[model samples]
Target chain A: MYNKIGPIFKKEFSSYFNSSIAYVFIVLFIFIPNLMFFYFFGGIFKEEMATMRRFFQMMPYVFIIFIPGLTMGSWAKEKNEGTIEMLFTFPISQWKVIAGKFFAAWALVGIAVGSTLFIPILTQLTMGDFDWGQIFTQYVGAMLMAATYIAITFFMSSLTMELIDSFLLSSSILLLLTLCGYITSAYVMIFPDWLGWLKVILNEISLSTHFNNFSKGVIHTKDVVYYLGLAMLFFYFNMKSLESRKWS
Target chain B: MISVKNLVKSYGHGKPAVKGVTFTIGKGEIVGLLGPNGAGKSTIMKIITGFLNPSEGEVLVDGLNTIDNPIEIKSKIGYLPEKSPMYQDMIVYEYLKFISEIRGISNEKADDAIQSMIKLVALEKVASKRISELSNGYKKRVGLASAMIHDPEILILDEPTAGLDPNQIIMFRKILRKLSEKKTIILSTHVLSEIEAMCEKVIIINNGEKVADNSIQELMKTYDKEQFIDFVVEGESLLSIEDEISQIKGAWKIEFEKKEGKNQFRFKALISEGSDFEKNLKSNSNNWKLVSSEIKKANLEEIFLKLTSQGEDNV
Candidate 1:
């Protein structure tokens, strides 16, 4: 299993690095958030906050588009180019292949997220105050959020052979999850008291609702479980999609 | 070494792509998978490769079940899909190097493997070129190189020579033959000549089912009774000749076609075994002159059409 996944990871990583697409996305992932922070929120470094509130806050939206782009071609491109058939003939577990691809994409997102740490480090050097705990919490939160999104995108990609369809499907789901809380709150305001339970269910499904607490410098166990569980759920679904394609 | 048992794969609960494919490819055997379009050839190949799970049966590679120990089974096999699956941006050497590394070869071994495979496939001229820049035939060579770079025991190739020039196809076949000395090869192609020339064993598939699985020699023997003799005749009108030829004893079937302006008729006479049909044609000289008459052996093309088309009707 390790041997199989190791090659898969290497192939996927090289595929990302050799293509200009990865560099383009890396630039957008890092530059756009900081640029927006500088133009709207005043330079992040000037604020002296170890917790990257601006960066972490913008990631949910950034990843809404970026994660789908990164994962849209994962299984979809393999299927499209007929490589998936090649991959299956090898003596490797289906889950290992899925994990190999998932972690490789996650690692790229990890590197992209890690690059923005320079901004926080610059703030710590110039400004006197730095909350190490809060920064760590926010970084963990960002990683978890990215992991969940990557899993979702990978699952969506596995279900379709078309890159555009994978992208649209993943983005649409992300959009719905991103807006779930707001949509539910608006419904609750107009609905009866008994129907307020719908808001609780909607909030539970909203990724941002759980991520927001972690971004605020508190590492809640429930939030950690939520993120990890969501990631695993999507990963499992991705494997099943691949397995189902063989018979279907 | 691979064993597939009663494998069935259906697309969306419709007609099964592979209804019940069962075969065993022993170690060092080069098997040719022959079929026409939509014959579930690719699907069966996929199932054996562990890419697509079998809906109703099991596949075992080297005694390891594909479903239970896919990784171990995969490590023993290398596969090239019909379209030459590859990363277009990476250089040929770099791509092979990556595959070598992923297959868990050491740096030194990876280097040696890559070097040998590049030489084996004659990719040295364009080793540094990006895969996207290579020609279709070259890309196929690269795909074959990747499949062999790891030195796996089994190689599964789908349509390995689909889009190559005649010269390239010959070279590719030579390379495959060389590799088969050390590895088992399952080659799928619609072309019958590929099987007759390269394969020791043949499996004919149609509509996702195995119609015939036997040695090439055995398949020929099965149809030996239906032997055909082709005769090119000069100075003969085909219309007048048909009745005289049909009346001959032991002539089970007769088909004739005329050549323009030449007064020549090509006759295909089907005869039973032990019949002196050639002597009978020679004796009838005044009615029709036998320009040339020889027994034509059944080639893979005829065998494939006979098996698949007739096999489908039986099913």
Candidate 2:
């Protein structure tokens, strides 16, 4: 076993913690979702039977904002700082470098997402109405949704050497992917024929479309395939862009 | 052993950065790649390191083509890029350790490699400090140390001493000199003296082409063979010797200046049979003694300028 991915993985993972912004990410990521669950969407105590539905509802919005911040620096900073020169010259394959950075960012986001485990457990402890299966699916859905976001941002980061440009481009795309599921239905009712095909396409492409069922206490094979497939597609796109950078 | 043949690299549709530049470096030979800014020196190094693909032609490292077998070629090379861009947050010692691991050196050997690199580049004092905290010179040493940690047989270092102080440059050259016995080195620099001191072979490139390729001794002897001869003669004034100086057949661009008590005259020489400028001067200036004369051959700095400036005019 070459274990080529281990050193890059270890270094990339520790680098996230080395900076103070990682703390900022965790605090805001955990705090904002809980805050919205408690205060903005009607308090947990205000409902007849409270659950983490609102928390799950806001997870996509939070990820659309934070995951770009995590991945914006992955390829963009390396390209800008010219570390890509040294890294690309190494004997290792380019995809492994992308994988190492992806796993590091995804795992860090996982920790921030994992801390929300206390959310479901607290609901179970305080109330007798929560479903363990729903909570599990929601956690699994959140993690998978994050994989797609991370993959998309990694692709965007590889397209440019400037960090700000990568952040802006990925952020705009992530926002569209998440919000399209909610907006496409309304647009279809107004314009039936042209907007009809959009519904079919967005159903397969939308981050919210697949995630909608998971939040409603159900998991399907199509949704799992949708997330993993999208994630893999974008990662492949990233590898292609890196190939162009080197070979072209 | 490395061989580059007819390498052509172009960005988009623009002019090729390297245009049919070909050279071969033998085993254990330290070759300096000298060029002006944007002269395709870095492009050649990048191609050799397997970081960039040549649009046409090929580079062979130990008989393996670069495009076909980049991984095997890369494994034998240790590269220090132009900027020496280390991860800013990584500690000096940690960076070397990372390189060792990626290079597939085991833990025990990696520790030994790290310690030796620290001592080699004199990075022991700041080994634990963050890379961003180190100064430019120290960062360069760290880059050099990291590149050599794998103990690769071929080294491709780009501007390795760009930011080092005088003392550090000497120390850097000393390290390279010691390593030259075992490693094949190809480095690029604008500082011609660095090449004169370190490399026996120098390749001067200009405008994406090889302008001159020869050793120091061969270059001095063959390149720009015309020499300048200076003669100090006892003379009252230029009027007395003007007629005799003009009759010199084998030289031109003659100029005279009065210094102390004698007149010193210099001319470019391309000596021919039976038409000697010194003989002419001596035959006419028998009235005034020829005090002393010296012939000055062109140095590396002059030859570099002559080669590259000529390149500047053509394209």
Interface RMSD of each candidate, angstroms, one decimal = 2.3, 0.9
TM-score of each: 0.84, 0.88
Model 2: pairs clashing at backbone N, Cα or C within 3 Å: none
Q: What DockQ class does candidate 1 belong to? A: acceptable
The CA-based lDDT of model 2 is what? 0.84
lDDT string, candidate 1, B1-315, tens digits = 689999898777588888889999999999999998889998888877777778888899888887788778778888898888887888898888877866778887889999999899999999999999999999999999988888888899999999999999999989987887888999999998899888999999988889899999998888765555778877656767766776665555556755735787787766545667777888876667778888876555555665666422211
TM-score quality measure for candidate 2: 0.88
Off by over 4 Å in 2: A186-188, B228-295, B311-315
TM-score of predicted structure 1, chain A: 0.93
Off by over 4 Å in 1: A1-4, A41-55, A122-127, A184-188, B229-300, B311-315
Report per-candidate TM-score of chain A alone.
Answer: 0.93, 0.94
For residues B265-305, write the lDDT of model 2, one tens digit per residue: 43333332243566666666644567776666656765776
